[model samples]
Target: MARGDGLVAARHLVHYGYKPSVYYPKQGKNELYERLKTQLTNLNVPFVPDFTEALKSADLLVDAIFGFSFQKPLREPFPSIISQMEETRLPVLSVDAPSSWDIQEGPPKEGPGAKFMPGALISLTAPKPCVKWYRGQHFVGGRFLTRSIADKYNIDVPDYPGVDQFIEVGVDADEKL
Candidate 1:
């Protein structure tokens, strides 16, 4: 997996004494991935050998494999891994969007790759329209925003109670977002 969200989740899990297993099929060419690897080592996150190891090590999955902006079909072992995850019937907490999903179209039900159900989805900034199809818990993260920023982008800002950051958006959304 790439550094970004994966690294952040790994650090938090380790800090909380949870043995988070990271799945990196190959060494990343980016500087950020290298930095993340070092930080994760310092944090003592277990870099599992492969997808099976990571899946076996986890009770549930925190899917930080790909962010929402990704548009290409997943390559190689990724498709196999996604299949395993689907067959295993594990609860997946997808960050941003489910890995390899079309940014606007959501999961590809019938295609070369990607057709799994995530148990929960944590959408940052703003949720895409496809998030509506998610039957499980849908959480809207990221608090502390300016009204102008939300208005400019037309992102519906949810109200928080006493500094709470995340909101579990249920059915019957206020039509603000």
Candidate 2:
């Protein structure tokens, strides 16, 4: 999983009164990642070693496994992990685009990625090109984007009501989830 996203998600979950456990097979050496992991530990979030065991009790899975930079031929461990996710059919909320999806191409036409579909997705900053294939609850986050940046990029920033951090797209404001 993406360590930074996982950290923020865990923090939010804790804030919203959910006890979340993380299963990270390989720890990062960077100080930022170290600090993030430490913060999770400080919050009493368990770092599980076994994905299979974690799956048995997990109510939902936040798939921060990969992001926009990922271009794959189904590399080690992830293929198996993603396969397991597919097999379970549990509700998965992918960060950014779903892991292994080509940003421009959307979901792969074949392979393990093709077999998996997350129940929801939260696009950071803005929605990527791949979102066209995402037939699930989609949310736009990173509300800190400046108006100047939006104009420079010709991005249509959604008019979020009040102090909401995220706004659901492709859905009516009254139908917020």
Candidate 3:
């Protein structure tokens, strides 16, 4: 809950008229995070202590616990947290990648990281390799990606429609409802 992605998501929720009750178990040491936390605090967003309590009252959960940098074999609190999230069967819109999911392998075939599948995923720059295994609504956002950078990386960024900040992209036909 101390990640920048989570912090930014919280900030946007406030901007968009959503009242987010953050479950920040550990406070971040970074100044950017502190500032974001302070900003959210100033806006009267409640930082709730109990994760289950927060989930019970939540309409939707935005999981930003981990991103592309995540490694295998999740540690304490996280596994429990993810398990709790799965138990709720709540609709989750994971930012970047689902927490504990392998960037290449996607969710594991079994065990700790397998059961939880986000209803939707918002890929930051471009979709990751794990997206191949993801069977849900997908969106891409990165207006800041320069042309040269895209060309250099051979990233096939779709042409955005109008001035939209984000665009929904089609997943595999089999994945469609």
Candidate 4:
């Protein structure tokens, strides 16, 4: 998704004792895919193919198909995958930003027919403007920001008293950044 965030998250899942099935876009063979495959192998997980396995097998889904750097107009397979996920009504945790979501503009506009509620959106580093209308749980991750860096980016982050890596923001909370 966003750089190596998805792969990194999958690795974390392994550390947390969850068996994660990673389904990349293409069949696993290339150099990058091989690297990911090796990592997954080391973690004792499966690096599998997508489409059905992703929707039918997993208890929950992680929307890491795209992140903050994703541009407009999703290509083939991704849109279908997202539509299938939505139809399945599975609980999804969007990593950084939801797939098909415009990084700066949020979810795509329904052309006069639908109103869908996307599930939880987790923003790393800082909250993106795309999260404005998200009603579900909003979590802020990437707990490495110093006050000076936060201020430099005009991000008003709260003081993390200890070793907290994640801070959940309420749906109605004012994130002054």
Candidate 5:
């Protein structure tokens, strides 16, 4: 998940009266995981490594590990962990598309081979291209709405535009834009 979206979702869930926990892979030396941990901590949300003990403790699980940026099959521990969640029949709420499913073409498989579709999926920014192609059985009644972090949290996101503004206007747009 994008750091911004994850934070906004964590905050929104808390504001709506739900205690949310953010789970990510903590094994190996992953700097990304550390950054995400800091972000979740800043939001005052709980963070746990992907483990059965953590999954078992949640009243609801929010699958935010794979968001719009995922383009390849999810590897290792994540896929294995997701399979475990499927077996438990826990109520899951995904942040965007379910892990392993292509956001543009629906899940890679169907029927018994199909992966778990969360009880609900909170689509951030906009509806993913796959949402329309996937059968209702995959998504069920599982869909929620969200806004971009800039819109939801009123934060300024930085990007290459800052450079363009500096070149064209001879001033730093990072502060103003």
Candidate 6:
């Protein structure tokens, strides 16, 4: 997901009465950074380079830094960034799997104080095998659904079940078949 799009998404959520914040490290110039800045400006969502400040100001923090391809020990910037995020102590909502986590086997078994641990994980498309195999106690919610972008294209999407509750789908119809 584009950083800009994430900002827009946050703005939309807030517009509809939800409190969300974007968190990222203060890395130097990059294409992603430029795009994110532009998008944040367009959406009019406040952002802070410091994770501590962002966390203090937000009720829910969305982690959109890394995708599902991460499969290694978190290095300097990421580890430092994740460390700051963890210190925030707010409920985290990761975009895909938690950063620095192994998507295939789940997060590494380093110890209780690992950087990949998140409060909540929002899986896109399909739920990663690790999510089920590794019992993430911090996991509070998830969405394993897909959406159609066009007539010919369908993409796996993360679940964003809002605060409202309802029963829209029936489960017994297919059992009769």
Task: Rate residue 87 of model 2 by lDDT.
Answer: 80
TM-score rank order: 3, 2, 1, 4, 6, 5
lDDT of 1 by residue, 37-133 (tens): 8999888777887787667657888877776756576778777776776676667888877776776676787754356767888887667666755
Where does model 2 exceed 4 Å of error? Answer: 171-177
What is the Cα root-mean-square deviation between model 3 and the actual structure?
2.9
Estimate the TM-score for candidate 6: 0.60
User: When superposed on Cα atoms, how far off is each prediction in RMSD?
Assistant: 2.3, 3.4, 2.9, 3.3, 12.3, 6.9
- What's the residue-level lDDT of 26 in candidate 4? 39
Candidate 5 is scored at a TM of 0.60
TM-score of each: 0.87, 0.90, 0.91, 0.83, 0.60, 0.60
Q: Which model is ahead, 1 or 6, in terms of lDDT?
A: 1
Model 5 over residues 1-177: C-alpha lDDT tens digits? 224455556766877888887654633355765565576678788766546877667776666666666666567765677677567677766655766677776666753216665666645433465555433222211113233645686543223343331111111212332
Give the alpha carbon lDDT tens digit for every residue of 42-146 in model 2.
Answer: 889888888988998999999887767677687877787878877876789889888878878877788778877888898888888888788889898878679
Ranking by lDDT: 2, 3, 1, 4, 5, 6
Error of 4 at 165 (Å): 0.8
Q: Lowest summed lDDT over 10 consecutive residues: which window, candidate 3?
A: 168-177
Clashing pairs in 5: none
Clashing pairs in 1: none
* Whole-model Cα lDDT of every candidate shown, in order: 0.73, 0.80, 0.80, 0.69, 0.55, 0.53
The residue-by-residue lDDT of candidate 4 on 22-92, one tens digit each, is 76773435577567667878888776666676567787777777677677566776677767756667787
**Model 6 ranges with Cα > 4 A deviation:** 1-5, 26-36, 111-116, 133-177
CA lDDT for candidate 3:
0.80
lDDT string for model 6 (1-177, tens) is: 224335545766767877555554534476766775666667666566666555555666676666575647676567766666556677766655666566676556663226456666644443455565333422322232323442244332323368522212211212210
Q: Summing lDDT over every window of 10 consecutive residues in candidate 6, give the lowest-scoring window.
A: 168-177
